[model samples]
Target: MAENTAERIDWRQLWASGDLARFCFICLGILLHATNETMVATVMPAMVGDLSGVELVGWSLAVYEIGAIVAGAAAGRMTSYVALRTNMMGAALVYSAGALLCATAPSMPAFLAGRLVEGFGGGALVSLAFVSVERLFPQRIWPQLFGVISAVWGVAAFSGPLIGALMSEFLSWRWAFGVFAAGGVAAALACLAVLRGPAATRQRNDGAPLPPFPFATLACLAVSVVLIASAGVDVTPLRSSLLLAAGLFGIALFFGLDRRLPAGRLFPAKPLSLATPLGNGMIMVAAFSVATVTFTVYGPLLLTSLHGTSVLTTGYIIAAESIAWSVLSILVANTPPERERGIVLAGALMIAGGVAGFAYAVPAGNIPLILGCAILQGGGFGIAWPFVTRIIVTAAPAAERTVASSAVPTMQRIGYAVGAASCGIVANASGFAGGLSSQTAAGVAAWLFLAFLPLGVLGCLAAWRLPANSASPAPA
Candidate 1:
């Protein structure tokens, strides 16, 4: 089937159709966005030194994430009302403004403010990129497109640190932020060129607007606060208790919203529907959950701690995963959708194995082992993400596609925050290699935390629920 499509649409035809160019532009934007994220982690300390807001470092990242989270649904709703090109341009403008703010920040408070604003734009842009694929491309090519997107991350991981380091060393840490701003400008220009004209500015009327503050704003607020409290800085009993209470309140509110809202208005269709593919959902959760911990925190820490690897090396290591993920993604994209479940299940197992290997190999202090584990994990990630995404896209109705797609990144961010917090708590308690007499304890804890990959076996079960008898896509 894939062979037929490949033969029919040659590269020239694909390019001529505009899908290829659109993907390229969006991918390039995402690639730069990704690079900024990884690069900044390496040069963050320098920023702190210059800015003297070491305590607010967590807030900088956290606030950005918070802004991004809030903007996800908003973007979806806007897409329904506005033209794709207009929506993208607006987001780019917001992002550019935020970047400029970051570049000029004179204090912790100011920098944090910049992150919050940037998050608003960044979140929308990222999710919209995926939504664009659904809106602009053929269903048959999603897996391949997703792989290509994943590869951008790999490329970013490989190159971001070097760019960040060079800018930081020769220029200043401020240059990191400046570089991101420049990238945003470049992407905005590309978008303007490729997606221009008055027709590009009109909003479609395919569906109703999403509910105001869908999924309960309180719930999202709580989760954000708890995540920040947990990962950001020192936790006192009072602060922890407050955060816990807020998080609980948020969770309760979300469930209430889920139950009370109508189908068209709800964030998740049915939170407690037993008939839903529980196994697949859990596996998906695990795959993303592991990603949150490993990539969000542990991977970066590994570079800064044991090997004293520079920002450049850290980027390269992360790039290794990106490369593996992209390669596997392209391979799986060509496979029949019927085989997607089995492929995903196999990928889950591989991811688990790789994580386990990393844990065992870490104690030996072999860099090769770590790199191998990253590659393995990347492959697993490559497989699971697109398959699960395909499931959601194929299952949901066209009108509800944006809402459903929003869940992917929402869950990913939630998983990442939870994973990073959990790992941070454990790693802090266990301490680093040289700091402790028995590095085994911390290493064991670290591996155990990352080994969350095996739990994705449940996703295999979810794949079983995909209707086997029907060739048509699932109802929205």
Candidate 2:
């Protein structure tokens, strides 16, 4: 127990002794990762038009997601067997190389290869990043440090696209990739001095054998390919069905491997076991609720096709949701626990409302209404995330905390993948017409599909199962 305590040290001393400068740089790396993901979404349409690879547009994002999920899952295991410094540095190097490929790639295949590499690097960085809080801080201070980390995400959510837009408009979309590469290199070097200082690797005995890599990678790849392929309407139903079947089969096989891993490992022991029901339920709520943010795709398409708005205007409108989400997140960190639950539940309801508000958008023909609905939805996202995240990380037994922490991202990735695919199907079936559809039909679909979000209200009810006394004290 003493040794275990040493490994998962409490939060107070860790925070006090933590190198703040290191935190700043690490947050910057996180910001860059978020930026790359959002920016690519904004710029990819333009890039596809320019590169004439319209057919491959969906694959660009899908491939990156595939790489990231595999990397994140693998990183959890690697953390058990490797020095923290080695994992951090290795991921940085790999990510940087991937970014370089993206910047210089002359063909669609090459760019995809680059995205794949970057995904691995980005995945590893994110999966292990929160563990640093565990390593550096004691338990009492975990919530506070986690709040700081959450703030970084809020900032990245808003700024990434704006930055990407400027890069795409004034310079070239290629510059977006180039800038990330430079940032990745600088982050790697900074960590080398502060994090990877010598002596540890030379002493031997990192941890244990890494789980066999083959099945995990294959399963992830299959899932990503199927999801991406489904986005194209041209694929025959027969082919799509086959791909979907193969992907599901692969995922089933991966889980079989997951069961063979040790305790306090694989899929966050707490969530998997239903030990932290409130946290686990809320994370699942987040999965369904947050999907509404993707409605931004409708914003641009609406502006350009229906309202005759320019690209710049569309960009600002799309950015409003992110900005709203960012600002509300900070406010949430400071909220009291009783207030936090109410606020989070309210947020889920609001997300549902905002999604339903999509129906109002077309009838009113009011852009401001659309924006207002987005902000309301964004606020819900902002409030719910921090509280749920706090609960999940802190609620578990110390021995299982690492696995618990890991489940948050794992659930998020799987959720996002499923959400994107499912939403695409919903939008298509409802006659969304890409971005050019009449507001009336799009609004109805948005409302109907969003009905799934309020279903998350069920999570709030489940929170009751948590010990009545089990609540965090008011935020300082």
- The local distance difference test score of each candidate is 0.62, 0.61
Local accuracy of candidate 1 as per-residue lDDT tens digits, 375-417: 8888887876777766665555666556565566666665554
TM-score for model 2? Answer: 0.75
* Model 2, span 1-476: residue lDDT tens: 89767566444655567555556666666776776876675565456546644344445655676778778767756755677667777888888889899988888779989988998998888766765656644466566556667777767777776776777778887888898898888877866667743322322345664445545544754464555346443444675566556655665555555655554245543343444553555454544433553454334433444455454545565578788777787776777665755665676676766766765663355778877877877787777766666666667666656565566666666555544444444444344423323463345344434544554444445443433322743221
Residue-level error in angstroms, candidate 1, position 469? 9.8
How close is every model to the real structure, measured as TM-score? Answer: 0.75, 0.75
**Candidate 2: C-alpha lDDT:** 0.61
- Give the Å error, residue 270, model 1: 3.1
| lDDT, candidate 1, at 28 | 61
